[model samples]
Target: MIILGLIAGALTTGCWLPQLFKSWRTRSTKDFSWLYLAVFGTGILLWMIYGAIKGDLAITVTNSLTLTLTLAVVGLKFWLDVLKPRVRARAEPPAGGPSQRSVLPVDARAVADGTGDPARAEM
Candidate 1:
């Protein structure tokens, strides 16, 4: 029974390491879902609290470790989604401006037919 408990703890702990490492190294969680991670972290925290209340060592240890891992992933996702993108967007110039290259000629037929806005017609 003790050996089984140890094995289960080790396995559960091992499963979270990969996600922790990936989030740590990349520092980017674009592909990760913040909503899912948030919900998952909340669930893990609840599990930890329940395990503690029940006085189950195995449940407590596993849930504690899982909560830590889930928090790391969730925090990274929040940073990437809320903070990093805003910083990047602020750094970039506004759109709808002139480019460095020469402008292409507009089609007269399209302009004559008024398919597009007349303001877009070439002089």
Candidate 2:
């Protein structure tokens, strides 16, 4: 029974390792949903609290570890999703001429009249 509990705890905790590793390596959470992770982390915390209240060591340990892992991933996701973009947007551009892709002001009147320069009209 003790061995089984240990194995179960290990397996449950191990489930989060791949996600943590992926998030760490990519350092981008564009594909991850913040709300989903937030909900999952909350659920794990609740489970941990319930396990503690029930006095089940395996449950407590597994849920506690899972909660911690979830929190770590969620925290990273939040930073990558919310903070990194803002930081990157504010970062200084390299010492070169502005890229051709830079935004150009459009002539709304020309667009409305449908007789803007051929290049600008296409855009």
Candidate 3:
């Protein structure tokens, strides 16, 4: 029973690794909604607490580790998606600043047509 519990716990907890790795590698968590992270993280915390109360080693350990991984992903999302953009915006001059130049050609049809799709524009 103990061995089975260990294996199950490991499999469930290890599932978080790939997503964590991708978020770190991309430095973007744009796909993760703020609401989902909040609710999911809260549920994990609740499960960990329930496991502790029941004196279940497998549940407690697995949830504790999973919570740590979830927090890391959430931290990356907040830093990369939320904080970094704000910092970059503050660092950059406002649009139409003297140093700013349009990347599109002056005769770009997308600009004239108001399509707003840079890819559709003729360079």
Candidate 4:
């Protein structure tokens, strides 16, 4: 039964990955409901507290890990969609620069691989 419970926990918790990845790739969270994550994560945190009080290892571990992963997604959503834009706005001006037209912003791999052209890389 513990094995089954752990498996279920892992399956459900793992669901966050694809959504997080989608948000990361798109650099947008317009489709994701922030309020839902906040509420649901609060419930998960409460469960972790309950598990601790009951000395239930399975519940505590599962909910603790889930809460961490959920918070990571929320942080990424804020960073990629919200803070990144403000930083980008500062980097570019009305006249524009060469960095503006040739490519979108990119990760270090693109620069390290000597393929600074993100559009050509199809990332």
**All candidates: TM-score:** 0.65, 0.68, 0.75, 0.69
Q: Model 2: per-residue lDDT, tens digit, 28-85?
A: 6667687787788788888778878988788788988888888888788878888888
Residue 11 in model 4: lDDT: 86
Worst 10 residues of 1 by lDDT: 97-106
Q: Model 1: per-residue lDDT, tens digit, 38-63?
A: 78778878877887898878878888
Q: Candidate 4 residues 41-96, lDDT tens each?
A: 99999999998999877788888889998898889878877898999989776565
Name the 10 consecutive residues with the lowest summed lDDT in model 4.
Answer: 96-105
Question: In angstroms, how far off is 83's CA in candidate 3?
Answer: 0.4
Q: Given candidate 1, what's the lDDT at residue 120?
A: 75
Q: Which ten contiguous residues of candidate 3 have the minimum total lDDT? A: 98-107
- Residue 103, model 2: lDDT of 57
lDDT of each: 0.77, 0.80, 0.85, 0.81
Worst 10 residues of 2 by lDDT: 97-106
Best candidate (score: TM-score)? 3
Name the regions of candidate 3 deviating beyond 4 angstroms. 100-123
Tell me the number of clashing residue pairs for each predicted model. Answer: 0, 0, 0, 0
Error of 3 at 99 (Å): 2.2
In the range 42-82, model 3's lDDT, one tens digit per residue, is 99899899989998888888889989998999999989988
Top-lDDT structure, candidate number: 3
Write out the backbone clash pairs for model 2. Answer: none
Candidate 1: pairs in clash: none
Q: Which of the two candidates, 1 or 2, achieves a greater TM-score against the reference?
A: 2
- Residue 49 of model 2 has an lDDT of 86
Q: How many backbone clashes does candidate 3 have?
A: 0
